[model samples]
Target: MDPQVTLGERERRTWAAFVTMRRDLEGALARDLARDGLSVSDFEVLARLDQAPGGEMRARDLAAAIGWDKARLSKHVTRMVARGLVERREAAEDGRGQVVVLTTGARQVTAAAVPNHVAAVRRHFFDLIEPDELDVLDRVLTRINARAVEG
Candidate 1:
C-alpha cells in the first residue's frame, strides 16, 4: 500500500456509513440499558456470567468470554461488586484464582432487560436489514471479526 493511493468516493462513503451506523446504534443501545440502571459494558459482563454454569465463571474466563482484558474486567467487576450486581469469590477448585458470580439482582434485571434489549436491537438494526442481505452481512462480519482476531 502506498500513501499516495487514497480511498475513492464510494469507499469513503461506505466506510463513513459503517462507522456512523455503529456509533449511533451503540448509543441507542446504551440509552435503552441506562433506563434499567445498566451500562452496556455492565450488561455485557453480567450477561456472560448469567449464561455460565452456576451463574459464575472463573474471572479470567469471564474476561476472555467478554473480550475484555484482565485489568478492565477487574476494574469493572470491582465497581459491580460495590453495586451488589456481582461478587468475586475465591475459586473452589484452585483457591488462588477468582470467580465471578452474578447476584440475584442481576438475574432479575437481565430477565427484564433481555427482552427490551432484543426489541431495541430489532428496532435499530435487524429490522432495517433486508432478508436477502443477512447472508452477506454475516459473511462480511465474520471476515471482519477474523481479521480482528488475527491482528
Candidate 2:
C-alpha cells in the first residue's frame, strides 16, 4: 500500500478489530492449553513432530515448518528437552546437523492435549460462527494465505 494512501474507515476498523480479536482469541486458547501443561507453542512443536515421518525432523526443518527462527526453536527445544518431551540427536546421515525427535512421553502428551485443545477451538471459535460464515472465512483466509506466500 502507498504510505500516502490513507486507509478508509472500513479498512481501519477491520484491521483494528482483526488484530484485537486475534490477540484475545490466542490468549484464551493459550490459557486453555495451560491446563494441559502445554503452551500453544509447545503444542505446535509437539504436534508437528508427532506427525513427522519417524516422529522426527531436522532442527532446521522443524524451525521452518513452524515459521520460527533457529534461535527460538533451539531455545524452545532446550526447554522441551528438560521437560523430557523431546530429544536432540546428531543426525547420523549428516553429522553436523541436529534432529529433533518426539519422545514417547510427548506423543502421550500430544494425544492427551489434542482433544481438549480441539474442544477449546470449537467452544471459543467454531461455536461463534454460523455454518455459512465458515465457508466465507475459509475462502478469505485461503486467498489471504496465497497472497501472503506470493510476496
Candidate 3:
C-alpha cells in the first residue's frame, strides 16, 4: 500500500461525516418532495428544465447537467412522459436529437414544489448556517468540484 494512499484519523472522520451529512440531506429533501408526489430525481429534472431556455433542453444535455448516463436519463424521461410531467420531442435546432420539454402539469407542480422545497432547505440547512459559513462552503465546494473534474 502506498504511504500517501492511507487516510489519517482526521481524514477518515471528515470523509465519514461528509458522506453521512450528504445522505441525510438528500433523504430529507426526498421526503419533502415525496410529500408533493414527486421524487428527488423528478424534482431535479423538472427544476433544470424549468430553468433552461424555453423550458426545454436536449436529452443528452439534460443527462450531462444531472450527471446521469443517457440510459438512466432515458428511463427517467420515459416515466415522466408517462406521468404527463414532460414530453419528448425532436429538437427544433437539431432534428436528430431529442429534447425534453416541461408539460403544463410539470410547470404547476414545479412552481408549487419550489416554495416548499426552499422552506425545507432553509429549515434543514440555511437556518443552521451562518452567512460567512455559506461563503466558505461555496468556496470549498467549488474548489472540490474543480478538482473532481480534473480527474
Query: Model 2, 17-92: lDDT tens per residue?
Result: 9999999999999999999999999999999998999999999999999999999999999999999999999998
- Give the least accurate 10-residue stretch of model 3, judged by summed lDDT: 89-98
Q: On lDDT, who's better, 1 or 3?
A: 3
Candidate with maximal TM-score: 1
For candidate 3, write residues 32-102 as lDDT tens digits.
99999999999989999999988999999999999999999999999999999999999777589899999
- Whole-model Cα lDDT per candidate? 0.93, 0.96, 0.95
Query: Better model by TM-score, 2 or 3?
Result: 3
Residue 15 alpha-carbon offset, candidate 1, angstroms: 0.5
Q: Write the per-residue lDDT of candidate 1 for residues 77-149, one digit (tens) a residue.
A: 9999999999999999879889999999889988988998999999999999999999999999999999999
lDDT value, candidate 1, whole model: 0.93
My TM-score estimates for the predictions, one after another, are 0.95, 0.93, 0.94
TM-score of 3: 0.94
Deviation from native of the Cα of residue 141 in model 1, angstroms: 0.6
Which stretches in model 1 have alpha-carbon errors above 4 Å? 1-5
